[model samples]
Target: MTDIYRKLYTSSMMPSINLPKHYNYIGAFLSLSCNLSCSYCINHLVGLDQRRKHLSGAEWVEGLNRIQTEGPLPISLQGGEPSIHKGFIEILNGLRKDLNVDLLTNLQFDPHKFMDLVDPERFKRDLPYPSIRVSYHPETMDLAETVNKVKILHDNGYSIGLFTVAHPDALEYIPAAEQACEENGILFKTKEFLGEHNGKLHGTYHYEGSVFSKEVKTVNCKTSELLISPEGHIYRCHHDLYNKITPVGHILDPKFQIDDIFRECTYFGKCNPCDVKRKNNRFQNFGHCSVEIQDIE
Candidate 1:
């Protein structure tokens, strides 16, 4: 069955002729469960009532291995906290060697255990950013302990860096955290805060009235990223993923192929901030949006 799926994916999905593919990033949400619950969590922006079912480690390996990408494209492992996935280490080791791997984490796991189980070379890719990005949340995480854990990973030959969102409530602590990271020889970066804070919207978005609006509108939309849910279902955008809407395809489906053309959407005003926010592309150019939307009504 795996061989048949691989063949179908290679023949129909891989070739650019059948699917109009233009994916710059691929995200794998191993699980939506996180240990820390940050108040400004984007995953909960649309409400977190829906509990997603997760695929086994073996299933993840089979489905993900079918993906064919060029250049330094890697399948990023992330979630509420990807490390919390029961089969996290297994999935990491199970991926094909040729496929580059990147991790987005909260640095809450034991670095010693990770280093013992996983080889550093597995994540070594020639990308501009480090393979492991540890998010520093002041609200829930201890700054000193988080720094210590990142340093341990860096010392053990892991490409790691620290990123903190500049939320309105967290702004005062960010400067101090940045100084600590710099002092420790760790790369510290700040991400623009998204969502509403004290009656003000934080980040810049491409479309007007796309986010935080109560009313829903119809629009044509297309995305540049491949977002996969824990259950192996492919989503059109983050909004669909969090809202438990219909999936575009499933990774395990032999006939599943990317259709890069724009599709009609009726939930424009209730869009996730992550999809509509103006941000940098792979080339680091500003004003790149994950999804392109048109015909707003």
Candidate 2:
């Protein structure tokens, strides 16, 4: 395995809970408020009844800087639309250099403004994937407009790419999108659609009944990813984060540490697809699971 992959599978280097030193991934949801309301949005799958809140840029910087890791480990800034955060630019400029930063966005923000405020090198890293991932939603996004924005960023030396979920309904449009990206010298990829569409589950999951099920069951579950909400609350999994369940810790807390152990969960059947899905690891190797669940009864 490469050094980067090794770090991902290694134990935590610092003394703070059992969080592996080379953590596989760190996801920071700057804000869950998105401009587009696609019909298949996973965030609204179970219905987010509460108003989402977000932390200021300074708070996010302070909290995220505390994280210690080595090598290719990156803190991914994502959200319903991360750029919608009030301090999006500040946060981008504020993260420590040692902490590699990646972004998942919709390419709806102003590229000129981003280029003016942020240094492109800050997002550059020696990794297999582009540092910035732009999602293309054919339903609500204009393909020409989105491609123009990506070209703007790409021309400015930012490491970026375009990804569209392979929704069954949207499959036909993907090839044309890919060809367009290729013509523009931009990387375009497709992600497997997760969750139910027309009463059928769409993705491969490790657990049998962890997604789209009406019944709930108890099970012991533990996560490998560090999922931080916009307000800095940490969750055991994506299911807990979007559903607003109690968090395991607050990133701002000086004493906060990751508890790398399994806890009992009463919503096994109602789990989010992101958490239970059997997918590729950072190395693109198949059969890797984000969380491990057992003890179901």
User: Which prediction has the highest TM-score against the true structure?
Assistant: 1
Give the Å shift of residue 263 in candidate 1.
Answer: 0.5
Model 1, 180-295: lDDT tens digits are: 99999999999999999889987899999999998899999999888888888899999998887979988787767888889999999989998999987765678889998988
**What is the clash count of model 2?**
4
The model with the greatest lDDT is 1
Error of 2 at 196 (Å): 1.3
Q: TM-score each candidate.
A: 0.92, 0.91
lDDT of 1: 0.86
Residue-by-residue lDDT tens digits, candidate 2, 53-158: 6778877876787787656778899988888889888888887787799999997878998899999999888888889999999999988899889999999999
Question: Which regions of candidate 2 are displaced past 4 Å?
Answer: 1-18
Once model 2 is optimally superposed onto the true structure by TM-score, how far is the C-alpha of residue 190 displaced, in angstroms?
0.4
In model 1, residue pairs whose N, Cα or C atoms come closer than 3 Å (at least 3 residues apart or on different chains), thus clashing, are none
